[model samples]
Target: MAKITNETKRYPTDLTDEEWTLIQPFLPKVARRGCRPQADLREVLNALRYLARSGGGWRMLPHDFPPWQTVYW
Candidate 1:
């Protein structure tokens, strides 16, 4: 797994190190010929989990997350 640079959990929705390792391989990765992904995959998942758990609108996501558009897409 790529090292998770931000280890501190800022919210209840963030992933733990063990959980991140198990899930990381399943997430889509950056294409070899395209621009690299702009947002961190782990953060995106955390934002998604927060949305699911809280039943919040995409726009309502906390600022610490990637933009709503990014997560929505």
Candidate 2:
């Protein structure tokens, strides 16, 4: 799979660096064991924000964001 990058702002729902800084402290840290996470938390959050703001179906999510299943569950 190609590497995913959260460096660019592709949507209006994406968090600004300052916003992420304020929100980052509240998110859970990665586990030291078990399966690693498949997606970036910030990207997932942005997907969610886009879905909420647009009121679109999960499967209809744009190609730029992570897969819909990743954001849905």
Candidate 3:
């Protein structure tokens, strides 16, 4: 595997493949299946960071993280 580069370095929001792989084991097994598949961990974490760094309410997070309402409260 290639070494981590500046652009690929983990931020408070980003996750590397290996990190994702480790977490994959714990991902919830949901009941929904689409014709396509998606894993949006980065999107959600980034949203979380936006809230954390900005000191904004979690409801201020982008719609990408749908649990934002509960997160805020």
The per-prediction tally of clashing pairs is 0, 0, 0
lDDT of each: 0.83, 0.83, 0.54
Per-residue lDDT tens digits for candidate 2, residues 1-73, read 2222367567778887777787889999999999999888888888999999999999999987889999988
Instruction: Rank candidates by lDDT, best first.
Output: 1, 2, 3
Q: Residue 18 in candidate 3 has what lDDT?
A: 66
Number of the predicted model whose TM-score against the real structure is largest: 1
- What count of clashes does model 1 give? 0
* Tens digits of per-residue lDDT for model 1, 1-73: 2344346677787888889988878877779996888888888888999999999998899998999999999
Off by over 4 Å in 2: 1-7
Q: How close is candidate 3 to the true structure, as a TM-score?
A: 0.42
TM-score on alpha carbons, each prediction: 0.85, 0.84, 0.42
| Model 1 alpha-carbon drift over 4 Å, by segment | 1-7
Cα lDDT over the full model 1: 0.83
Q: What range of 10 consecutive residues in model 2 has the weakest lDDT sum? A: 1-10
